[model samples]
Structure formats: C-alpha cells, structure tokens
Target: MEETINLKELFQILRKRLLMILAVTFTAVLASAIVSFYFITPIYQSSTQILVNQKKADNSIVQYNEVQTNVQLVNTYSIIIKSPAILDQVKKQLNLDMSVQELTNKINVASEKDSQVFSVTVQDAKPELAKDIANTTAAVFKEEVAKIMSVDNVSILSIAEVAKEQSPIKPQPMLNIAIAFVVGLMVSVGLAFLLEYLDNTIKREQDIEKILELPVLGVVTKMEEKKAAAAAVTKVREQTIGS
Candidate 1:
C-alpha cells in the first residue's frame, strides 16, 4: 500500500520530540548570543557628508545645468575618493600604520540617485578611528578633487563625530539569535520526523497485525498490569477473611 502521513501523525511526531526540539533551539540561541556578545568583534561606523556643487566664476547663482553636471560627476568622484592619491595623503596626515589598499577597504563613498550630496562612510573596530577616517577622507577628497579635476566644486557639509555612547554597526546579537532560532527549529523538527520514519519496530497490536498480515485474536497484558491485578485480588481476599 502507498503510505501517507496525515496532520495528526505530524502533530504526534512533533509532540513526542518536543523536549528535544526545545533543547536544540535553546542551544542554538544560546550559542548565537555567546558568539555575538563575546567572540565577534563589533564594527563601528562613522560618516561625513559633502555637497558637489559647481562654483560660478562670475559670482552668480548656481544653475540647473551645473547641478546636473555635478550630479553626474559623483560616480567618478566616488572612485577617486578611495584612490591612492587621496588615501596616501590621509595616511600621512593621520600617521596610520595600514597600507593604502588596507585603508581603501575601510572607506566607502556613496551618493543618492540624481542627488549632488554624497557621503563618505568609514568602518573600523574603534569608534574614534572610524570617525577620524571619515572626516579625514572627506577633507582629503575635497582638497584633492580640485587639483585632479581642475574644479573647485566639492564642499564639506558635515564631518564625522564620535558620540559618548557610540554603538557598533555589526554583529547584532538579537538578529543573530532570531536566525539561529529559526534554523534550529527547522533542523530539530526535520530530525524528529526522520527518526519517526526510521523506527520500524512494532509498537502496537495494529502494527503487529499489519506487518504479519494476520488477525490478532488476543492481546497479552503487561507484567506490571498483571502484578497490579494480583495485588488487588490479594487485598480483597484479606478483607473477606477479616470479615
């Protein structure tokens, strides 16, 4: 016969292995918490904003065409900001021990679509270092962009600053734990069903009859049940004798 599982069987399997499922899930959540809180190093973030606007030589108001041009240049400027030209100067000024390539990995230059305002973001293990890198990168980019492109358009709108209670941007413990909980639940439930499928030993009268292809004429009582019945009979006999 083609065998199929129903909702009741599914629930029964889950219920039978409920404690194992909970233990696994709890272990996963605990491991995630421990790793996130103690093992993983937190990454701190800092960012500085810069505005890309063209300067009019005649000292007049900026026009739409200039703004559009500046917006188009943001992509090119993003690359230049992380280039060796700007990073080299930043390293020298900051006296950083890391190489230019390593420093480039920590910096990111980004801007919104069709917008002239771009931001320089830096990430590091130290909050103060992150803030300093952000500000220094923006400063270097602003000064160097003029010399490289022969235009004085970039303006520093904001600089990065470290707060007293700065929080790390990476290794979120709660989120990690939540993901662990979901994965653990799925794995544990799957294991429970797998064990249920693997178990082929007879557990009931129906199993015996089904496997043997014969009718079950009688059922044998358990030893504990027989002992309990004999004890009850002996108690009744004692009571009758006393009467």
Candidate 2:
C-alpha cells in the first residue's frame, strides 16, 4: 500500500513544532548580532581623484585623439602607482611599516573608459590611515610620472579626506543573521519530522490484520472504569471497618 501525507497533517506537525523553529531562528539571529557588534572590526576607505589629459594644451585638435591618448596611458598610470619607485617613496615619507607590495595591495586604481578622470582608493582599519595612504600615494605617483615621462599629463584633482562615517566591509550582520536563521529553521524542521516518523510505534489494527493475512477475532474496548470504581469502594469499606 502506498502512503501519502495530507496538507492538514503537515500543518498540524508544523504547528506542534513551531516553538522549536522559533528557538532556532532566534538563536541564529542573536549569534549574528553578537559577532557583528562585538567581535568584528570595522574597516574604513579613502579615495583620491586625478584628471588625465594629453600633454598638449591646445584643444583645437579633435577631442577624439586626446581621449584615445588618455585612455591608452591610463593603464600605464595604474601600474606606475603601484610600482616600487613610487610606493617606496610614499613609505619613506609616511614612515610606514608595510613593504611596497603590501601598500600596493591596499591601493585600488580605476578609471572610466574614454574618460580623462580616474581615482585611486585605499582601505584600512583606521580611518585616518586610509586617507593618508590615498593622498600620499597619489601625490608621489604624480611627481614620479612627471619626472620619468618628462610630461605633466597627470594632475591631482582631489586629495583624499578622512571620512566622517565608518563602514566595514566584512561581517555583514543583518544578511548573515537572516541566512543563518533560515538555514537553522530548515534543519530543525527536517530533524523534527524525521524523529517523529522514527518514534511512531503504534500500528492500526486494520494494518496489522492486512499484514498478517487473517481476520480479527474481536475488538475490545479495554475499559478500566468499573474495576477502578470497585477498588475505590473496597478501600473505603476497609477504612470504615478499621475505624
């Protein structure tokens, strides 16, 4: 025989185990909150902006050629910004403990396609350190590029400023907590149903009869009310006789 579960039964099971599900969800959410607020450190970001332009000051020529030149040279600037020649000077000026490679890894250089403007960003746990790194790197990169290329094509448009607001990149509490809660709920509900199925031992008489391939002799109510009452009466009589 095939066995099938109905919606009503499912609803009943869920309702009965609702407390367990809620407990799991609350636990997951609380754990996320605790880790995010107390255990995780916040990260801060600082950025510097630079304008890239052709060495020639004359704008009479078609702007298209200048745009192409700027785009082609942007990759060179990005690499130069991370090179040891620039980063080593920055480290010396700032008296930083990190090596050139470490500083380079912290810096991010990006520019738009066919655009004359680009930005360099740095991130660190300390807000002021992030701002200082960005500004110093940009200034050093501008100076070094001018000295080497013998052209003043790169110029600092904006120096990085310390951010008033702090934002962390890691350990997103709300998102993590929500995911944990959902996963915990699914696991708890699955375990609940599994245990319930495994622990059920009482079998219907009809099922037993079918399995045995025999007819049932009779059905007994197994009532205990009469026997219980007679025992109570006999106890009362014994008490009265003793009195």
Query: Top model by TM-score, which number?
Result: 1
* Number of the predicted model whose lDDT against the real structure is largest: 1
Q: Which ten residues in a row have the lowest lDDT in candidate 2?
A: 1-10
- Write model 2 residue lDDT over 1-243, tens digit each, in one string: 133445666676778888887897788778888988789887778899988885565666657877788878888888888889999999999999998888888899998877778899998888899899999998888888989878888889999887466566666788888888888888878967876668556456775676787888887655599987898899999999999
lDDT score for candidate 1 against the true structure: 0.92
TM-score of each: 0.86, 0.73
Q: What does candidate 2 score on TM? A: 0.73
Q: State the lDDT at 208 in candidate 2.
A: 64
RMSD of candidate 2 to the true fold?
A: 5.3
Clashes of 1: 0
Model 1 spans > 4 angstroms off: 1-5, 57-61, 209-215, 225-243
